[model samples]
Target chain A: MRNHNVTIGIFIVSGLALFTLVLFTIGNEHKAFSPHVDLHTEFANISGLTKGSDVQVAGFDAGEIADIEVPKSPSGRFRLVLRIDQRLNPLVRTDSLVTVDSEGIVGDKFVQIHGGSANAREAAASTTLPSKEPLSLADLLESSNDLINGANGTMKGVQGKLDGTLDAATKTINNANDLIVGIKQGKGTVGMLLRDQTTATEIQQAVANGEQATVSVKQASASLKHASGQADALVSDFASRGLGGKVDQTLLSARGAAGNLDSISGQLHQTMTEALGEDGRGVDAGGNIQQSLSNLTETTGNMAADTEALKHEFFFKGFFKHRGYYSLADLDPTTYRNDRVFTNPDNGRAWLEAARLFEQTSNGQERLTTEGKLQIEEAIAELGDGALNGPLVIEGYSSQSDSGTQLAASHSRALLVLHYIHARYQVDLRNIGAVALRNTPPPGVHKETWDGVCIMALKASS
Target chain B: MIGIFDFVGAVGLFGLRVIGSVFRIPFELEQIWRHIGEAGVRSLALVLSAGLALGVVMTLHTRGALVMFGATAMIPKLQSLGFFVEIGPLVAALLVAGRVGAGNGAVLADMRATEQIDAIEALSMDSFKFLVVPRVVACVIALPLLTVFMDFCGILGGYLSEYTLSHISLHLYLTRAFQGMQWSNFVPPTLKALVFGFIIGTISCFFGYTTNEGAEGVGRAATSSVVVSSLLIILADVILVKIIFLTFPGSAT
Candidate 1:
C-alpha cells in the first residue's frame, strides 16, 4: 500500500512538472517573462495587421505587436504598440523607419523596423516611429495597367503612321507606272529620244559639228598667234634698224587723213541733228556739233601720235595685237557639220513590236496567237545578238482596275509569255523578268483599245 | 412517465447529496488517496497511449489538408492549437470516463448487490461519504493532471511524427508549436476538464449507487455509466466551449 502511494505521488508530481513545462514554453513565446521595451508607431492603413504580429528588426524577429489602438486624435490611422526585446532597444533609433510588411505575396503581415544611422539618437520607450504603408496588390495592378495602356497607345500611333506611309508608297508606285507606260508608248520626250531615229541622228550630227568647230577654233587661234608673233618681230626689226622715223612719217600721214575724215563725219552728224530739229523742248537733244568736231580732231591727232610711239615700241604693239583662241566663229550655232551618230545599241533594245506576238482585246486581255509564237521566236533570235543579249523584260498591262485580282491576272499573262519564250528558245531563265503594271497601259493608247505585254529587252547599264 | 420523473429526481438528489457531503468533517483521506491512485496512476499509460495516437493521426491529417495551401510547415502549431483547445481535454476526459467511471460503477454496484454498502451503513457510517465522495473527489483532482500529461504526450507525439517526415529538430518543432499559443488557449479547456471530471464521477456514482436488480444490474450499471458519462460530457462541452469563447474572445479565434 505504501509503495502504491509512492507511485501515485510520483505520477502526480510528474504530471504537474509536465504541465509547468508546457506553460513555460507558451509563456516564453508570449514574452511573458522577458524584459521588453514598448514602442509605438502609426500607420494610415495597416492592411489587416493584428495584435501579436511579429515585429522584426533588420529582418530578424525581435518582438511582437502587443496592442493596437485607434486614437481619436488621428481618424484614419491605427497606433501599434510593439514589445521589443530590451537588449535591442539601443539599435532602435529615433530616425529608424518602420513599415508594415507581408511575409510573401499572400502570407501573414508583419512590422519591419529598419535601423537608423549609427550617429542617430536612441529612440526612448513609447516613442512613435515613422511608418510607411505596405504596397497592395490592387495598387500594383493599377500602375501596371497604366503602363500597358501607354505602350498600347504608342503602338497604335506607330501603326497609324505606318498606314500613312503605305498609302504614300502606293501613290508613288502608281506615278512610276504612268511614267513607264509613257516610255513604252513613245509618248513623251524620253520616248521620242529612245524611239525616234531621226532625233537620235540629229543629236549625233550636233555632237560631231561641235567637235569640228572646236578643231577649227584651235587652228584659227594658232594662225592668229603665229601672225602676231611675226608682226612683233617685223616691228622690232624696224625699230632696231632706226627705220622707226619713216614708219612714224607714214603713220602721221595716215593720222592726218583720219583727222580730215573725222571732221567730215562730225559735219555729217550735225546735218543729221539739224534735220531732226528738237522744236518742242528747244534743246539740242541729238548732238553738240561744234564740241564734237573739236574733240574728234584732237582724238585723231592723239591716235596718230600714239600709233607712231607704238611703231617705235614693238612690245606694246604685240601685246595689243595678240588674239585669244575663243571667238564667235568657234560656236557652230546653226548646225554641226559632222554627221557621225554614236547610237547606243542598248537604247534600241526597249519596247519590241508585239502586235503579231499577242492577240489584242479591247477589254485589255492579251493571249498568244499561233502567229504570235513565231513572232516571239523571231524576236528572241534577234535579241540573241551580242549587242542586245540581256534579260527579256515582259511588262504586262492592266487598266481600269487597281485591285490585286487585276494585278494577279496581269502577272499570269506575263508569266505565260515568259514560259513560252523559255520553252521554245532554251534561253537561260535568269535572263527573263516579268512584271505587272496595274491601272496603266502603253502610253497614248486608251485602255479600251490596247492589250499586250510590251516585250522589252533589258541591257545592263554601263 | 412516472419512471422518467423518478429517474430525473434520483439523478438531481444524487448530485445534490454529493455536493452536500463534499465538505463533511473527518474526511476519508486514505480512501481519497486510494481512489486517486486508481483513477490517475492506474490510467496514466492508457491516457498517454490515446494522446500520442491522436496526436500522430491529427498531424498526418492536418498535413494532408494544409499541404494544399502550402502551409505544411504550420503542422506543429496547428497540432498544438487543436490539442490544447479541443482534442486534449476531451480525449483525456472520455478516456477517464471509460476506465475510471466503469471501474467505479462496477465496483460499487457489486458492493451494493452483495449488501457491502448496507453493511457499512448499519455500522452508523456515512456510506456515500466513504465510497462516492472520495471517488468523485479523486476524479475531479486527477482529470486536470491527466489532461496536462495528455497535452505533453500529444505535443511530443506530434513532434515525433513531424520530425519523421520533415526532419525538423525537436527544439524547432516545440518552438513553432507553442509560438501562437496564449494562456487563454491553455486555461479555458483545462478548466472545462474539471467539469468533465465532475460529470463522469457524479453520473457514474448515481448509476452505481442505485443498483437493485442483483448481479445483472452490475453489468448494466457499468455500461450505463460509460454511456451516460460520455453523452453528458459531450453535451456539457458544447455549453462550456460557448461560455469559454464568450469569456475569452481571443481564444475563440
Candidate 2:
C-alpha cells in the first residue's frame, strides 16, 4: 500500500512539474515574468505584422509586439503597443524610428526599432516613437517600372537627336569632299587657275610684266637723282661764265630733261601703285591683284559657311551621319581624346618626338626636319600598304608651360607634318586630318604628357 | 430506440444518486486513494507509450508537409501545438477510458455479481459512496495529470524523432517547440481534460453499478463502460473545445 501511494505521488508530482515547466517557458517567451515597458507607435500600414511578432531593437532581439489597435476610420493609422524588456529600455529612446520589417522575402513580418542618438532621452512607458510605414513590394516595383520607362523615353529622344546630328555631319563632310575632288579635277574656274596650263602661263606672264615695270620705275628714279646733280653743277658754271649764251642753253636743256624725268617717274609710280598696292599700306589697302585675291578668299569663305550650314539642315542630316566624317578643325583636345576614330583599337600609331622630328628656324619658327619626313614615311610603312585606304589623323601634342603656347606649337607641328605627308607622298588630302591636342595624348596611349605628333592610321580589322 | 432511451434514463438516475451520495457520506478518502493509484499510477506506462508512439507518428507525417514549404523548422512547433491543443488530452482520455474505465466497471460489476455491495449495505454503509463515488472522484483527479504526462511525453518523442533526422540540439528543439505556444494553447486544453475525465468516470460507474446480470454481465459491463465512456468523452471534447475557444479566443492561434 505504501509503494502504491509513492508511485501515485511520483506520477502526480512529475506531471505537475512538467506542466509548470511548460507554462514557465512560454511565460518567459512572452516576457510575462520579466520587468518590461510598453511603447507606442502608429503606422498607416502594418504590412501583415501581427500581435506577438518579434520586436528587434537596433537588430537585437529585445521583445515582442503586445497589442495592435485598429483605427475606427479608413484614413486613420493602426496604433501598436510594444512590450520591450527593461534591460533594453535605455536603447528605446523617444526619437527612435519604428518600422515594420520582414524576416525574409516570404517570411513573417516583425517590428524593427532603430536606436536613437545618444543625445535623445530614454523613452518613457507608453511614449509613441516616430514611425515609417512599411513599403509594399508592389509600390517599389511600380516606382522602378516608372523610372525605367522614363529613362527609356529620355534615351530614345537623345538617340534620335544624336542620329540626326551625326547624319548632318556626314553629309556636310561628303559634300565638302566632293567639292574638293571637283576642284582637284579642274572642273571649275578655281580649278583652272590651279590646274590649266594656259591659265598658269598667263599668270607667269603677268608676273614678268610687273617685274619689268618695277625695273623701269627704278631707272626713272635714278635719272631724277642724276638731273638734280646736273642742275647744281649748271648753276655753278653759270655764275663762273657771267651769264654766257652757252650757259643759258645748258640750263634750258637741263630744265627740260628734269621736267621730262619728273613726268616719267610720276606715271611709273601711279602705274605701280595700281598694279601692286601702295608701299607700307598693306597688300589689301588698294590694288587690282589684292582686290581679286580678297574676292576669291571671300567667296571661298562663303562656300565653306554654306557647307557648314548643311550640318544643321534637316535634309542633309542623315546623309552626313552615314558617311561618318568629322571636321578635324571642329575637334577640341577633349573631343579628340575621346573620339573613337583616332582611339580605335585597330588604329596604328607612330610617336614622333618633337626634338627628333623638328628644328627651329632662324626666325624662331618650328619646321619638320628631313629626318622627320623619313620618320613619317617609316611610320606609314609600318602600318602596312593598306594604311592609305582609311582616314589618318595627325595628333599633335606639345608640352609647353603655357596653354596658348602649347596650342600654337602643337598646331604648327601638326600642320607641318600634315603638309609634308601630303606634298611628299602625294596622299589624298581628303584621307588625312590634323588636330592639335595640346599636351595630352589620346587615352590608351600610355603617356601622361606628349611633346610630339602621333600618326594614327585607321586600319580595318583583319 | 425505446430501449436506448430507457437505458439512458436509468444511467441518468444512477448518476444523480451517485452525485448525491458523494456529498452525503463520510468522505471515502482511503477508497479514493486506492482508486487513484489503480487509475493513475498503473495506467502511466500505457499512457506514456501511446503518447510517445503518437508523437513520433505525428512528427513523421508533419515533417514531409512542412518540408514541402521549406518550413521544416516549424516541425517542432507543430508537434508541440498538436499535442497540447488536442491530441494529448483527447488521446489520453480515450486511453484511460479503454484502460481505467473498463477496469473500474469490471471490478465494480464483479463485486455486485458476487453480492459484495449488498453485504456492505447490510452493515449500514452507503455502497455507492464506498464504491462508485471513489472511482468517479479518482478518475476526475487522475485524468488531467495523465494528460500533462501525455503532452510532455509526446513532445519528448517528437524531439527524439526530430533529433535523429536533423541532429538538432535539445535546447534549440525545446525553444522552437515552445516559441509559438501560448498559455491559452496549453491551459484550456489541459483543463478541458477535466470534462473528459468526468464523462469517463460517470458513464463507466453508471454502467457498472446499474448492471443486474450475473458473471456474464461483468464482461458486458466492462465492454459497455469502455464504449459509452469513450463515445461520451469524444462528444464532450467537441463541446469543451468549443467552450474553450469561446472563452479564450487567443488559443485558436
Candidate 3:
C-alpha cells in the first residue's frame, strides 16, 4: 500500500512537470507573455498570405501576421493585423510602405515593411501603412510583346530599301570583278603595266630619254651663257683690231637659230592647245565641248603613245602658263589616271571625295565646296536619272569609324549627294539609292578607289 | 441492430448516472486515492513506452517528407503539432481503455457474475456508487493528466530520434517545436480527453454491471470494453476537430 501511494505521487509529479513545460514553451513561441505592438495594413489582394507569415521591416524579421479580416463591406479589401516585437516598434512609422513578398520564386508569402523618412512620426499601435501591389508574370509578358511588335514594323520598312540597294551593289561588284579578271589576264593597259615585260622596258627607256632631255636643257643654258660671253669678247676684238669677220658672222647665225627654236616651240604649243580645246570652245565629233576636254584628258593620260604627247610631256607642260590644264599626267605615269572609271558610254561614274564635298571634316551635316558643285553637275548628267540604265546609287563609305555609326554617317552623306542631284536634274528620288559601308568593301568589290567618299555608280535595270 | 441500440441506450443511461453520482459521493477519499493508483500509476509504463515509440515513428516519417523541401528543421514543430492535436489524446485514451477500462470491466463483471455485487447490496451499501462512481471519476481525472505526460514523453522521443541524425540543441528544438502552437491548440485536444474518458468508463461499466453469462460474461465484457471505447473515441475526435477549427480559426495553421 505504501509503494502504491509512492507510485501515484510520482505519476502526479511527472504529469504536472510536463504540463508546465509545454505551457511555458508554447507561451514563449506565441509571445504570450512578451510585450508587442499591433500593426495594420489593407491589401486589395493578399495572394494566399495566410496567418503566421513573417512580417519583415527592412529585411529583418520583426513580427508575424496575427490575424486577417475580410470586412463586411463589398469592396473586398482585406485588413491584416500583425503582432510585432516591441523592439521593432521604433522602426515602424505612419508613412511606411508595406508590400507582400515571397521567400523565393515559389516560397511562402510574407509582409515586407520599408521604414519611412526620419522626420516621419513613429507608428502607434495598429498604425496603417501604404501597400504596394506585386506585378504578375502576365503583365510582364504583355509589355514585352508590345515592344517586339513596334520593332518589327520599323524593321519591315527598312528591309524594302535595303533590298533595292543590295541589288545595285551586287551588279556593280560583278563589273569590278570582271575588270579584276581582265587585269589578271593581262588584257588591258593596266594589265600590260603590271605583267608585260616589253612595256616595262619601254617605260624605262622613256624615263631615260626624259632624263637625257633634262640634261640637254641644262647644257643648252650653259652654252647660251658661254656664247654671250664669247660674243661680247668678239665684238670688242672687232672694234679694237677689225680681225676675224667669219667668226663674228658665225656667232650671229647661232643667235638667230636659238631665236627660231624658241618660236617653233611657241607655235607647237599653240597648235596642240587649239586641237585639245583648252579654251573650252572647241567641240569634238560628239558635239560636246566638255566631251572634247574629257578626250583631251584621256589622250594626255596616255602620254607614251605619240611624239606630240612626248614633246608636251617633256618640255611644253613645264613651260606652259596655264595653271589648271597642266595635269600631273605629263610627268608621272601613275598620276591623274582615268582607269578608276574604265567605261563611259554616255552613263558616267565618278568617286567624289567626302573631304572635298564637305566643309566639316568628320560626320553630320555637310557644306558644299566649289569643286563639289562642279562634280555634282557632272555626276547628274552622267547618271541621266536612269534614262540610260536603272537607278543611280550614291554609295557612302567610311573605313575609320564603327560600322553602324560609320554606316549611318555614310547614309547621311549619300542623302546629301542625292538631294543635290535631284535639285539640279529634277531626277526622281525613287531612281536614286543611298548605301553605307564599313571597312570592308561591298560584295565582289576588289578594292575601294575612294575612301571617305560618295561613289556615284550606274547599273542597268536587268 | 436491436441489441446494438439497446446496448447504446443502456450505456447512455449509465453515463448519466455516473455524472449524477459524481457530486453526491461525499468525497470517498480512500477509494478515490486507491483508484488513482490503479488507473494512473499502474498505467504509466505502457503510456510512456507507447508515447515514446509513437514520437520516434512520427519524427522519422515527417523528416522523410519535409527533407524533400529542405524543411528538415520543421521536424520539431510537426512532431509537437501532431502530438497535441491527434496522437497524445487518442493514444492515451486507447491505452487507458485497453488497460484501465478492461481491468475495471472484467473485475466488476466477475463480481457481478459470482454474486459479490449482490452481497454488497445485501449489506446495505450502494454498489453503483461504490463500485462504478470511483472508477469513472478516476478515469475522468487521470486520462487528461496521462495525456499531458504522453505529450511530453513523445516530444522527448522525437528529440532523441532527431538527435541521432542532426544535433539540434534541446532549447532550440523545444522552441521550434512550439513555434506556431497556442493555448487553443492545447485546450481543445485536452478537453476532448474528457469525452473520451466518459465514453470508455460508461461503456465498460454498462457491459460489466449487467453481466449475464456467469464466468464467460467477464471475458466478453473486457473485450467489448476495449472495442466499444476505441470506436467511440475515434468517432468523437472527428466532431471535436471540426469544433476546434470553428472555435479557434487560425490555430490549424
lDDT tens string, model 1, A339-365? 111122343233333455566567866
State residue A394's C-alpha deviation in candidate 2, in Å: 42
**Worst 10 contiguous positions by lDDT, candidate 3 chain A:** A328-337
lDDT-wise, the better of 1 and 2 is 2
| Ranking of candidates on TM-score, top first | 1, 3, 2
What is candidate 1's lDDT per residue for B58-121, written digit by digit as tens? 8888887777878766788889888888888999999999999998899899999999999999
Candidate 1 docks at the CAPRI level of: acceptable
Each prediction's Cα lDDT score?
0.78, 0.86, 0.76
- Identify the leading candidate in terms of lDDT: 2
Better of 1 and 3 by DockQ: 1
Question: Would you list the clashing residue pairs of candidate 1?
Answer: none
**In TM-score terms, which candidate is top?**
1
DockQ of 1: 0.34
The CAPRI-style docking tier of model 3 reads acceptable
* Per-model TM-score on C-alpha atoms: 0.59, 0.54, 0.55
For model 1, the superposed segments whose C-alpha errors exceed 4 Å read A73-76, A102-108, A135-462, B1-13
Off by over 4 Å in 2: A44-54, A67-75, A101-110, A134-462, B7-25
